[model samples]
Target: MSSSRILLASRCATEDEISELVFKLQALLPERRRQHLRRVSRDEVLEEVCSYIRKLHKQVDDTSERISQLLASADLDADVLRSLLQQ
Candidate 1:
């Protein structure tokens, strides 16, 4: 039996984890939907691109916070915000 899928963001994935994300994206889209996306109008393309970027940003932010919590749990010294704010 085919499993039903729920659409949701994987917030734990880091910015560097996009390779894995592309594989999931390809899996999520059906063939006809993929084909339509490929041949979509300029407005639709831009909107979809913007949506993807926003989702990526959300994923990256979530990953950052999770990493911070892990570091604190391990009693390690690290400040991701400090580094980002530094440069």
Candidate 2:
């Protein structure tokens, strides 16, 4: 094959791989989030993923804080608390 044709083929393969990955990412998102968007672009997929990640992080932080407060109020022994946390 000529050099130009080889380059074109390689580029097409790369684009296809990227498109497949984006589709997979979109699939991983929640149904409600995906329902509103039709014919989304790559940038929109990335934005949704970022938003989902941020929401998850916030939930983790909130849960951790609540657990700490409950442990403190209970006045549990240090060893017991540590073991509970490990579990």
Cα RMSD (angstroms) for every candidate in the order listed: 15.9, 4.4
Point out where model 2 deviates above 4 Å.
1-13, 77-87
lDDT of 1 by residue, 1-87 (tens): 223222222445544465455544644555664566765454565555567678889999999898778666764344864675468
Q: Estimate each model's TM-score.
A: 0.46, 0.70
Backbone clashes, each candidate: 0, 0
Q: How good is model 2 by TM-score? A: 0.70
Which 10-residue window of candidate 1 scores lowest in summed lDDT? Answer: 1-10
* Per-residue accuracy of model 2 over 28-80 as CA lDDT, tens digit each: 88999887555989899989988998999999999999998897689789899
- TM-score: which candidate is best? 2
